[model samples]
Target: MTEQQQEETTADQLFATIGEQADNESYDENKVVNEIESLCMNCEENGTTKLLLTVIPFFKEVILMSFECPHCGLKNSEIQSAGQIQEKACRYKLRVNSKTDMDRQIVKSEYCVSKFPELDLEIPAQRGQLTTVEGLLGNVLEDIAIGQDVRQTEQPEAYQRIQDFIEKGKKMIEGDAFPFTIIVDDISGNSWIEPKPADAQNVWSRVEYLRSPAQNARLNLGNPEAPNVDDIQPDEVHTFPASCPSCARPCDTHMKLVDIPHFKEVIIMSTACDDCGYKSNEVKTGGQIPPKGRKITLKVDDADDLALDILKSESCALTVPELALDLHPGTLGGRFTTIEGLLAQVYDELYGRVYSGNNDSREPEENKKWETFLGNLTLAREGKKDFTLILDDPLAGSYLQNPYAPDDNPNMTSEEYERTEEQNEDWGLNDMVTSGYEEDETPAVIEAPDFPAGAPAA
Candidate 1:
């Protein structure tokens, strides 16, 4: 066929499939379209399956599907993420204390496991869903009710126990059980819980952690076997096959050990995901913890101080009194960056967390306070304001550059002090018996009571 005829034939085929010509300009990406008719699993009848390809405003692309059977009146719905997997597994914990909290939106991925600690109930990983808290509980109730009638007849005791649990779940869904906890753990890191202003407090918490090797293997990204560190040399950068945390695609992680002039040796590791353009670098200090903790204080009065390099270990606690910034250990992990870049990161982190969601829900006074704090932080980050930067590390692994080479900077001071018992416990050092653990593990012997034996014999 001619080129024009071929194009016409393709257009005709498209029109025949859809039964109409598609609108080009007025297309809605979120609109659900009938994709196909498939056999219904329940009734063996044909069911209409509709599909929606859209991107979540706060997240990424996801495919929503629904199936309905006219003959059997069967209906089903599910959601699947079309985006790449996140770099870290995520867990969301929410304290449901009111009706508003119950209405919170939840995106539960197929790899997510939800738990209700208060009710001692756990929902294992299943089909992905976009639902509210109450809706999820209602679905659980319906599932529990499915085999209940038969159980009531065959296993009366078990039926009563399950019925009681069902009643409790119903109460929770009905808002009678006001105060409870819901935890969503998603290894794929695609699930999400809607955040409210209450989340800024203890009512809600979200934590992201590195996935275990088993989890990576389950995802089918790469081999779960760990790389041999013995082959890694300090002078050469070792590259290993790995999976990208963001995309779950095959990637490489590069690691090298570098010795600082005045400081100790540290491992520098970096990972770049070509599929998603996600790059990350972290420093790992490898050495015995110092006997004493070190605290470094720098008065940033001159803009030149911001150009100084800094090494903030994972165990370092950073503080800026002037900016009212106090960050605990493990806040930003380990970093080797200039003072300006670090401050900028600190500003960005605080800004993002403070204003992550809607700010109109916050009180005017509280909003104003946060705005002022951010403004001061911005000024400090730009080196336009004076602030005192303090790095307190229990391991004494942190470092700040001294422009005076052999001499200490006039504006900087370093002090070492004994770590407190609480600090040791926090670091898990209190339980560490490096040298005499074998002696401590030896079982103690006990002799029988001779006097008691004699009395029994008499």
Candidate 2:
């Protein structure tokens, strides 16, 4: 029989024994425990007996019970030594196999906490989120509006604890509401939108960081510390707040690079409102970069004469490259340590776009000069970042909108999709078994024993 069947058999035995004992004598925890062990051990080894006994919880007399999965992880969150528990965690003693008195005491207490899910517990359900904002704190302008974070980047650990807290507080989820992001105004009038990969292929050698003290500082972080991979910047950057047409929400948009099934490489741009929960992700495929002969336009949206005037003005407009290199990079305001570091440094700080906010909204003509200087900007070159996008047109996304309204977003989500379409379809329709089904074959009609011809009717 299966595990479930074994559990059912064990439950039946326990109840029968309990009933028999009650009829003879009185309640006894020791006797009950002994009976449980005796009957449970003898139960069929199949899963049937093991899986069936949970129903005993509803019995008023069954105050305590124990179960052990043959194979399962222990002390799930982290490993702690007996020494540490003694010093720091009075309640977190280890589960040891010494069979000594101290070991038995520790195991008993720990098992009591673990088995009784209703009791107090200690574990950080959520850990290891980002530690810094870095060079990514700009005002995203989408469709001329601002944007914010509406949902907490879904960390399953956080929500699990949150569920525990809610359970303890006796709060009911009247409706589904999970907000994650925070939306804010474009106070700085600046923002960068781009894709951030959870893990990247490149790493800065120690020598590389030392070459440019300034660049090292940016990658290093707000507070100087030992350099690590986590310190590196992203490959692409974008400005936000025009409003993602799909979600109809506004905020600075950035993408966390994730693998798209079947597709080679693609970047997903997203903007989530902090207040009203709304978000949109625009997946831009890794397209072939135009050859060097391709004609690129710089849509300054300003007049040619005005560009000359600005150059001649007391404060000339800084080139996009200069703006990206010198003024950008780092977590917020550190410095660049190398001339050729990450692509973000090359674009946002050195060769980045710069606008006086007075340029014509249609200055695609001004790009002629930069286009000539850079030559046929062959985008598909090998050294270029893969599965990423480089969009300079600030006006390319004017019509984008947020898809959902506020109060609808979930706070956390699983990194992977839980159920596929096929599984969901099966949910509403269970096994096609018919209720109270009768055998289709006609029951054989037992011929009445032939009565003797001369037999009298009684």
Candidate maximizing lDDT: 1
User: Cα miss at 292, model 1 (Å)?
Assistant: 8.8
- Colliding pairs, model 1: 87-245
lDDT for each residue of candidate 1 in 52-72, tens digit (9 for 90 to 100): 654443344567789999999
- Where does candidate 1 stray beyond 4 Å? 1-34, 145-160, 170-179, 196-201, 224-231, 240-253, 261-264, 271-280, 289-308, 313-333, 346-377, 383-458
User: Quick one: best TM-score, which candidate?
Assistant: 1
Q: lDDT of candidate 1 vs native?
A: 0.75
- What's the TM-score of each model vs. the native? 0.65, 0.14
Every candidate's CA RMSD = 12.2, 34.4
